[model samples]
Target: MINAYATLASLVAFAQDRLKNEEKGATAVEYGLMVGLIAVVIIGVVATLGGQLAELFASVSEELPAVTTTTTTGG
Candidate 1:
C-alpha cells in the first residue's frame, strides 16, 4: 500500500512539473491578445469613417435642388 501511494504521488508530481515548466499555453494567449487589439483598431477606424461619411452625405442631400413649377403666357 505504501509503494502504491508513492507511485501515485510521483505520477502526480511529474504531471504538475510538466505543466508548470511548459510554454505551450503562452502562444495561445499571445494570439488572443493580438486578435483583441486588431478588433479594437478596426472598431476605431469604422467609427471615424462612419461619422465623416454621414456628414458628407448630409451635405450632398442639402445641395440637391427641390422641384419647381413655372407658367408662361403667349400673346
Candidate 2:
C-alpha cells in the first residue's frame, strides 16, 4: 500500500511539472486574442462606412427623375 501511494504521488508530481512547462495552450490563447482584435477592427470599419454608403445612395436616388406613365385607348 505504501509503494502504491508513492507511485501515485510521483505520477501526480510529474503531471504537474509537465503542465507547468507546456506552452501549447498559451499559443492558442494568443491566436484567439489576435482573431478577436481583427473582428473588432472589421466591425469598426463597417460601422464607419455604413452611414456614408447610405447617404451616397440617398443622394443618388434624389437626383434621379421620377417615373410617370400615361395610357391611351383608341376606338
Candidate 3:
C-alpha cells in the first residue's frame, strides 16, 4: 500500500544519501588509478628497454653454459 511505497522511497533516498556521504570507496578508487598509471609507465619503460635487455640476457646465458662446463671439467 501507500506505507510500503513511502518506506521504499525513504530507503532509496537514504541509500542515495549514504552513497553521497561515502569516502572509503573513493580512496580505493584513487589508489587503483595510481597503480594503473604506474603499471602503464613500467610497461612503457620495459617496452623501450626490451631489445637491449634481451641481448644482455642472451649474452649472459651463452657465457653461463660455457662457464658451467669449464668448472665441472676442472673439478
lDDT of candidates 1 onward, in order? 0.60, 0.61, 0.70
TM-score of each model, in listed order: 0.36, 0.38, 0.64
Clashing pairs in 1: none
Residue range 1-75, candidate 1, lDDT tens digits: 355456546655655675699744345655565566567656767786998989998987776543222222321
Which pairs in model 3 have colliding backbones? none
Give candidate 1's whole-model lDDT.
Answer: 0.60
Provide the lDDT at 36 for model 1.
Answer: 62
Task: List candidate 3 stretches off by more than 4 Å.
Answer: 1-26
lDDT string, candidate 3, 4-75, tens digits: 456546655655675789634445654565566567667767998999999999999999999999999999
| Candidate 3, number of clashes | 0
Which lDDT tens digits does candidate 2 get at residues 1-75? 355456546655655675799734345654565566567656767787999989999987776543212222321
Ranked by TM-score, top first: 3, 2, 1
Clashes of each: 0, 0, 0
- Runs in model 1 lying further than 4 Å from the true structure: 1-26, 54-75
